[model samples]
Target: MTDAILRVTGLHKSFGDHHVLKGIDFSVAAAERVAIIGGSGSGKSTFLRCLNFMELPSLGTVALDGREIGRPAGGDGARYYPEAELCAVRERVGMVFQQFNLFPHMTVLDNVMEGLVTVKGMKRAAARERAAAELEKVGLGAKFDAYPGRLSGGQQQRVAIARALAMEPEILLFDEPTSSLDPELVGEVLRVIRQLADEGRTMLLVTHELGFAYHFATKVIFLADGVFHEVGTPDEVLKQPRQERTRAFLARYTEFGF
Candidate 1:
């Protein structure tokens, strides 16, 4: 953990009266692929979003590459991060949400290029080149000129992946990237993500595809009611969990080989 690429300590998040995440601590070393699994309302998405300051945590600190982000505000003791600081963290931590979240009006290539040009401030031509390269990596180079509306759900998600990769993030966060895709399309997106894992890309993924997680993760964490119920290697956590909560959860995924 001392050499962790991304680390969280005492992480907590509350939405007004509802506490989504509570006192969670986690860290991933460079090139580690972490798979987080849990039932709905287990704070999985909230926890992932908090890492990038998208859904600000009510407490705790997140660090990237040994540098902690945010600071305590004087009065209430809640963490406060400046917009500039958050922007920089985002550039380092790329995220893909459950939904494709693509721009219907923009071509696939333009959608991928936007972050590079606007946020990274790269020259237009350079951004275009990088975006094209990333798209190619996701096997969507042929779809560059198509709009999100014109592509299948799987292809749209691939475009989202290309956009995230174009930023060259130190780590990638995937929040159920295939959740919205049809069953037939899920495999295509999983294949691309699997390829990234094979390449040793650092990633944290929240997914229900237990079979894929069994094969894809270096570490598997089981979250329950905002806490890590169990954490270990895929075989230990998924196949031979130490906690009753984790066992019950895995039982429901019997067909998935979890």
Candidate 2:
């Protein structure tokens, strides 16, 4: 058995004739924080989505904890695991989207508890306890009864994070988690993520915050045109990139004093 917690090989995705991700391959080790960075239209989000099977790949293999997720049915098409297996995979691989994607009608606590109760079949009382603990982890315990509308963008996002955490997933995938927040609120959300990173939680984050990625990621991958242009430690990839494309891209950020 390999030490990799997640492994993706020959990943490819296309929208009709327009290909987005082109034969990508990568892996994440246990407790490793990997940050995927790239400009718009670079397939960063699509790559992250493919990991959890949110967007099915046109081709490739994705394995979590040594088990291959979707398998090839016949011909060139891929056959995803049955619903039961998929559900189990999803439960183990938690995802936090760019948007909060919370239920507006439910209170923060209910929103967090819903998955535990529904998917995990957890008792309401036990789910409530777990939900509250997760919310407290994100520093939102006091807002349990508050509706999403009553919370600030950062708070709502934290609720979403808590909801994912309540599942006790083995790995977390963050897709530009701070992109939609107001600049003032971005710091709060980043702090919560930073805390998770400090706790050695395995995470794969797609982010635009170069500084945060540099500080939080144990490894950094630079994606371009659906391929990994550079992959290395934060300092190696972000600061001393050897690839021309990677250097040019980082130069733009540096020019603006990022």
The TM-score measured for candidate 2 stands at 0.96
lDDT, candidate 1, 173-230, per-residue tens: 9999999999999999999999999999999999999989999999999999999989
- For model 1, the local distance difference test gives 0.91
In candidate 2, stretches whose alpha carbon ends up further than 4 angstroms from where it belongs are: none
- For model 2, name the residue pairs that clash: none
Error of 1 at 210 (Å): 0.5
lDDT of 2: 0.91
